[model samples]
Target: MSNVKLKNSTTELRDLDALHHLHPFTDHKSLRSGGARVIVKGDGPYVWDSEGHRILDGMAGLWTTNVGYGRSELADAARDQMLELPFYNTFFRTTHPPVVALSQKLAGITPAHINQVFYGSSGSESNDTAIRLIRHYWTLKGEPKRRIIISRKNAYHGSTIAAGSMGGMGHVHKHSYPVYEGFRHIMDPCWFDEGQDGESLEAFGLRAARALEDEILAVGPENVAAFAGEPVQGAGGVKIAPPSYWKEIQRIVDTYGILLLADEVITGFGRLGTWFASDYYGIKPNIITFAKAVTSGYLPLSGILVDDRIVAALMDHDDDFNHGYTFSGHPVACAVALKNIEIMERENLVARVADYGAPALAKLLARFEDHPLVGEVRSVGMMGAIELVADKRTRRRFDNPGRVGLICRDHFFREGFIMRAVFDTMVCAPPLIWGDGEFAEAERVIGRALDLTLADVAGEIAA
Candidate 1:
């Protein structure tokens, strides 16, 4: 794809893509010029392109394939449930078995205090529910002015109007559409990029975390309701916040009596070494939005786990809580989610991620620690990022981020790997099921790509 002019011999996929494909975050014309490489199927850690080339899913299907691809068990559970009950809208006080059972299982596994759950069909929808619920909850308590929800700059939440606004990804915001009112963007604890020289990581973390306090105070604490953030910033180039950041953030939110909403859409399940990134970071959020691995993405399922305090407030005051989706608690989706959790638990997959994921991934990272073109190798559990820079000393990005990253991405794709180029940062949140060998293979492939990228993008990187 360096100068994508490839031809599609069989026009089946390309024709469909050209006719009906309105891709998100893509240059449609460029994609049209480059015939679409339709990923027809996947098995375990690999997927086959339309041309039958096997590519290792380094990004794990946009960081969602926690249990890995071709897990027949998930398929089987979905199939069985679909046959029994395909679709039943969770409306008009109708209840279902899977929804009830799954909620119970989730509550049992998650921290005891964070027990109440609200269901939605997607991460975006779940976050939407969270924002509304958070605001409405505050309103119910007569604190109507506590409406502002704080989010970090460069954060990626979701694409819905509310969720996108809650997220701080600049490109995600639509000026014409204008973000909905009451969502404030704040600086992140991105140590590598923003930390000043001679500052200790811990010191930098505390300073960064205090920004939330500044925001709350600036906005007036009485007007701030919640602070929404990802445990490990996923799409904003896998920006790992400093160690003390979450603790400080929790302290600030607690001081202001504000809610902490953890958007663990990517870092939840087994991706973050623990069952949830909030648990891993020791930040007990008031509300946590989850998706992706809820059912290993087998069926569209997402949720928000609410803290006991919020639940108690709503229960004692509100008549019925006043909000829910038609598919709030779909039985089959919930059933599959329960099964996915069971599979993860029965195999100790979360423990495995903590024990083996980082160590195995460390080897790959070690190779880049001293590489000339590499700026940083940051990792937490299976979640990691390899940032490329022109001047490592100055932290200068390549002149043409799109071109340079695309070169690396193209080479890797052609050489049998699938990893996303987040600007010039290559991100990886592979499935927890990956073993030592898979890690090594990914490293080798990536190393080869880097070598070629450095050689190929010499002019672009230099410019």
Candidate 2:
């Protein structure tokens, strides 16, 4: 660790935090009462808190940090780029070498049809760009009325007004000041929760996919602009789509001749054991929203991969697109992204996650299947989720959903592991760099936390 100013104690830092910091998605009253766990530093798949606890990060820093923490190579890349060209805009016909190279690199790895990228600073910004791009594309194609975009309930695209509107989460929408118009949502293809009694997983998935078709027809196919979805719903509890879902969605989009937008913010890079989850699912989307893992959370960089068709359409229009961010295609961020991809390629991190990390995690999590409190254990690539239920046979949830999940999440923290609780489902997306030993450690810690939570919840239920 570098020489830095030291605080008198963790309590001092917590006091400072409580005084000023308004954390995202946090309750001020709760934070003021309990204080916050201040993370001091990080290395590999672990982070040290202000109290000096070496906690294993099972959620991979909000589903980013796929390459893990404290990689000097990435830091060096940023430093070199900053020294050479710290900042430059991709607006007003200005161009930079780093952005140029990064664009080419992204094109090379993304789907064949996607050869163009529009950069932004975060996933929310990228989805906003996507909305404008899609709506403009339709306008250029002489379909100005085709503005409706369909999303799935519980899907999380981003938190911006435009992006959050694109997402289907009711909580975000409820609080969203002046929610944007022209968005419709259908049922999510989460078989574990929504599947009917005795309904096969494949059948349930197909039925869910049909919801998109139903919505499109209701809105009228000619009036719909595009359909947006995450390849795997990350914030929606790591909900993996059943085998038949993506294929049917692909058919629906193609049949309507409307655009298909894949929100790859969380599932992009190696999180899905492929360059992008669309490739894993064999679905060809017209636009792909990417962020988070592209730079492995080392730097803020997000973009939308526009299919060649859209690029061609824009070219034919010969009208100014007139949409961008101040830090679009930023040189230093682009340079760090290049270095991040290089490291992934050199280390074969994608292959490692596929052949080593994912299988190990799946095997370890599968043991919880027969546990009394566990209703289901599902995983894909390095991400997994364990759903907690009051009655396993009935898939009945606790009296108050998310209360038990919060309890389990607390246990994970106390036990030196970090897993996020989405309602009653405990989800994890550990770093791709984690190997057998890390997986084993995570399994052991998580198992112990679950046992403790089961007992705690049992007493609560009895009471």
Candidate 3:
């Protein structure tokens, strides 16, 4: 354990990455100047960077890693499947056993009326499928004009052209070409920032939900096919939805005969103390997109779990749906995901999160609830955020997003907690399997970083 040599031999990550890797969502020029945080190994919720620093994965490796890291069972499952049947395509009316078994398990666990699974490799692509399938569902129903898909401001779906446009992240879409056509946006049901002086949280939730109704009516109900949302907005600052919000959204979509597409990429696979976020929210979506935790981030795997009725419509039409990926239900990915789900069940991780999570994490957050820079501390299940605002009284954001957030995140990174600032909020979604001690340590570390960073910023402002 004495210094595992700063990086692997032959090529230091800095030197190799400089010449070879073009990192995603990063400016290559800036990356070349600053270098990378190369992760070397992981075991049970803790990872070591190339520097040999033990880093707690506060963001759960992009909000996946549900069963935690270094599970030998997942590796064994992948190895077994790779040897048995390495490759197959579901495109040519051909299917494989692992794929079949996974679909059955997914359907069985999913709430009633959702009976089919369409596979992809990530949430972005799966949501891209939802975009295609939902719009086409209208065409099959003889309402071809209904192509608009409504989303919310600050909502994050994914980075694909269609999915990123579906999101309202200014950072993602600003320099890029215009957002995808027909992906309409409305305000988020974020009560803390958007609620007025006298408005109740319930009233604000309804008001925000009503924006969808207003937009749909303005565009004409015939022109709108579906409304897409995360059950609880993740990545967009972990915004919690009020109880009235989802029910009202369901009511609105039902009233207009529009489809409800729940993007469960982060909230799926027991992240929310349930199999699907939709179940926790108490609303049924016609289509749902999932990824990240499916294989516990072991292998890239994602899928759209469709309502049986949507599948029924496609069955009645042409025999072929004319959509799929080359790696659609790829055997190895399926094997790994099946193993991940099995681990979740055998250990009862879902129920554990529901029962023990709040008390386990709340004490830590309560300590920072009164921190001056903290505008809010909100969490449900294992996912949470502590938002930093220039003025908590007004919920006013700092003039610069990346500057303040990046400064705060750098502090956390130095403290050996790998957390990120999404917009102005510091996000923390640790592996659900983390023990109480690790959980407490994570909050303590993050809290320390916040105090140091907030004071530095305040001093600068005063100067």
Using lDDT, give the best candidate's number. Answer: 2
Candidate number with greatest TM-score: 2
Error of 2 at 168 (Å): 1.0
User: Considering TM-score, where higher is better, how would the candidates rank from best to worst?
Assistant: 2, 3, 1
Show where candidate 2 strays beyond 4 Å: 1-5, 460-463
- Residues 160-204, candidate 2: write the lDDT tens digits: 999999898888998788789999999999988789998998999
User: Candidate 2, overall lDDT?
Assistant: 0.91
What number of clashing residue pairs does each candidate have, in the order they appear? Answer: 0, 0, 0
| TM-score of candidate 2 to 2 decimals | 0.98
What are the RMSDs of all candidates, in order? 3.6, 1.7, 2.5
In candidate 3, what residue range of length 10 has the lowest lDDT sum? 1-10
TM-score per candidate, chains pooled = 0.95, 0.98, 0.96
The sequence of per-residue lDDT tens digits that candidate 3 reaches over residues 1-463 is: 2453543542465777788878888878988888888788999989997767999888889999999889999999999999999889888679999999999999988989899999999998998999999988888888999999999888888898889988878787885587778888899888877888999888988999999999999999999999999988888888898888999999999999999999999999888899998999899999999999999999999999999778877988965677888999999999999999999999999988888874576666767887878888888888888888888777777887767888899999999898878867887787889788787788789778888888878953321
Which lDDT values do the candidates have, in the order given?
A: 0.85, 0.91, 0.87
Report the C-alpha lDDT of model 1 over 225-306, residue by residue, as the tens digit.
9999999989998899888888999899888889999998998897878888888888889888898898887788889999
**Pairs of residues at least 3 apart in sequence or in different chains that clash in candidate 3:** none
Better by TM-score, candidate 3 or 2: 2
Lowest summed-lDDT stretch of 10 residues in model 1?
1-10
Q: How far off is model 1, as Cα RMSD?
A: 3.6
Task: Please report the TM-score between candidate 3 and the true structure.
Answer: 0.96
